[model samples]
Target: MDDKYYTFSYKLRGDYKASPQYFFVGTHCANEFLDITKHDPLPLFNPLVHEQENHSPGNSPSSSSGDNKRLHPFNQELLTAINMLCISWDIIPKSGLDKIITFTRRRSETPNYNGIEWFNQIVGKDRQRRSLRIMIDQLRENNELKDLRFDESNNYLNERDIVNNIN
Candidate 1:
């Protein structure tokens, strides 16, 4: 059970041997964890799942109303904004966008506040196009991705648009 003497190895060693030559196996997820060495860790941040969803923005809730109706958490709101464009077919898109808008308006005293900077960072530069690719790929046979594109409608509000309006 000496961790230092034996780094974790892919092959279950029947007998102990001190050798760096052993290939450390990727995650036990098999297909899911395929090629771990070439990739970053699954949970890439202190708060992991959030980052996987785009970022690990930590969050909690507060409300001026005290009624809990508008008391949605901050991270949830941030995530909601990001989801407006970079969608996933898994679950919660329209609702996520609503939460984003609602949370920003309620929280930010600045009329200049918009979620675009964050959105860009989440999906990376030109991620809007990347998001489109993801959505389009979802339509293919192998890419049964969830449908979460926000621009499918003319009325879809965007954070960058809001920022432009404020500016």
Candidate 2:
């Protein structure tokens, strides 16, 4: 299949006459259950039934409580769905796993998603701030000109050429 891209936005609060929280982005055929790659997966599942099983990142083999075993029979169904998607697509998950963890307890304005502790370790404490300062300066001064040229011929192949390439 050719590459496809989607941008998902959760419903921002306002009375749009629709459910304020449920707005999601998806391909024409995709549904909420299949959006685990983009957001937290558990909320879409049966809320009353699911026992929280904390499998650390990379499925660390930590044992779940005894109740978890009883739930495993039903949990396998969830696994099957995920397995099928993994089998078909490369599953290049654009959203980081850390965001799912954070979404559970806190609101977005409280604490921003984590940065994996490496950017500060390697690039020093001020690198991010310095980069942002430079970006803001360029924006305000309007001195950083963007290259506004494109090679149209290379990108826009004639219909005949496109058909020929496909054939």
Q: Which candidate should be chosen as best, given lDDT against the real structure?
A: 1
- lDDT per residue for candidate 1 within 105-156, as digits (tens), equals 4655432123534443334433344543354354444543434333311122
| TM-score, per-candidate, Cα-based | 0.24, 0.18
lDDT of each: 0.33, 0.27
Query: Tens digit of lDDT per residue, candidate 2, span 1-167?
Result: 31222323344557554432323333332334344455322222211123336332212222222212232222222222222222223342223322322341233223211221221121122234332223323433533333211123112323224311100
What TM-score quantifies how close candidate 1 is to the native fold?
0.24
Give the poorly placed runs of model 2, Cα more than 4 Å off.
1-106, 113-130, 143-167
Worst 10 residues of 1 by lDDT: 42-51
Give candidate 1 regions above 4 Å deviation.
1-67, 70-113, 121-129, 132-145, 152-167
Candidate 1 displacement at residue 91 in angstroms: 18
